[model samples]
Target: MKDLTILCGVEACAIFQNSFPEQPTIWPSVGEANRIIEKFRSLPEFERVKRMINQETFTEQRLKKMEAMLKTQQKDNRHKEFTQVIIQRLDGSSAILPLKTDDDCVELDNVINQFIKDIDRKMEILQNEGSSSNPAPQVS
Candidate 1:
């Protein structure tokens, strides 16, 4: 397996986190980051940063992790089809909600997949920009 830490140092990764705080992308946890850093320690520092967010390396792992989380939260709905409704009342307002159906679950799954794809697209842009082996010359 290719080590991702080789793509970016901890400081550079930190800068990326700070630079995009609100972005929906998943930031690797500290332990994960540390492991990646250790694994790729042999690579040059700049090369590591360039490959920091390699999709081919992390995408499947991340998807599986996300799937596990979703599984833990999943409800067993073996019963016959039904609609779950929630009602709410306020001083001057009322609202109602229904439980998700099979279609809803499928739609949500598609959305999650698409969301991952979007994150990959963003990471690709960052990776390409970072991959330059030479630093641009500084202006006087």
Candidate 2:
């Protein structure tokens, strides 16, 4: 059996998204992405940030770790499902458990923010002229 050491983060997301056809005819719309992010931000798990509007749960340290983890995974469909889970969690879907406590909320919020940053970074890298490697296997 394989291990799933990394928590939900940007690298995991990149792995999943990288599998998309080089030129996807149907990419997620900006509105959808924003909605996903917005929903993630509001999930109960992010209470740390909610506790203090000025505090930064999305710290640089965690972001870097998330980035590192994201880089290790292979592209897969899990990214879409992960995004959907976040969206559902935020959209008042009672079928799932809400972020339990302040710490959980804050931690998740930080991770989600980091995931966004990772995606943006990947986009930037993709836009720039660069060398490439053979893609890895899809995780899911």
Candidate 3:
């Protein structure tokens, strides 16, 4: 019993049966108990139990603490305001457009629209060339 307490936490004997019903909860030696604990730690149920403990620990007080921390971070970021638009091309090249004003955003939108139009025109040209090369069969 004392060895079980040393290997596991306190009250090892009391909660052992309920905690691990399938496996033998009471081990004769501390080393054996430690091996069993290690074996159980590898199990998925161990991870699920850890997650449940974590979820249980996240009380309202912890949430308030997190909210306060977030508010402080937001206050810190209020002074520095900038927007970045990332455009990733098919050629594995990327462009980052930094926008500080409404006019800059509008310009970016126009550029994107123009680029789309250019791509559409190129696709149309390719489609027309393909159709011309392979004409439809005549129904004689």
RMSD for each model, in Å, please?
26.2, 30.9, 15.0
Across 1-140, the per-residue lDDT of candidate 1 in tens digits comes to 12454555333223143465584432355566566567688788997787666777699889999998776555333111112111122233344423267766664455456657988999998888887756778899
Tens digits of lDDT, candidate 3, 30-73: 67667766765676986747634455477866989999999888
Worst 10 residues of 2 by lDDT: 8-17
TM-score (C-alpha) between model 2 and the true structure: 0.27
Which residue runs of candidate 1 sit more than 4 Å off their true CA positions?
1-99, 133-140
Give the candidate number with the greatest lDDT: 3
Best by TM-score: 3
- Candidate 3 local accuracy as lDDT? 0.62
Clashes of each: 6, 8, 0
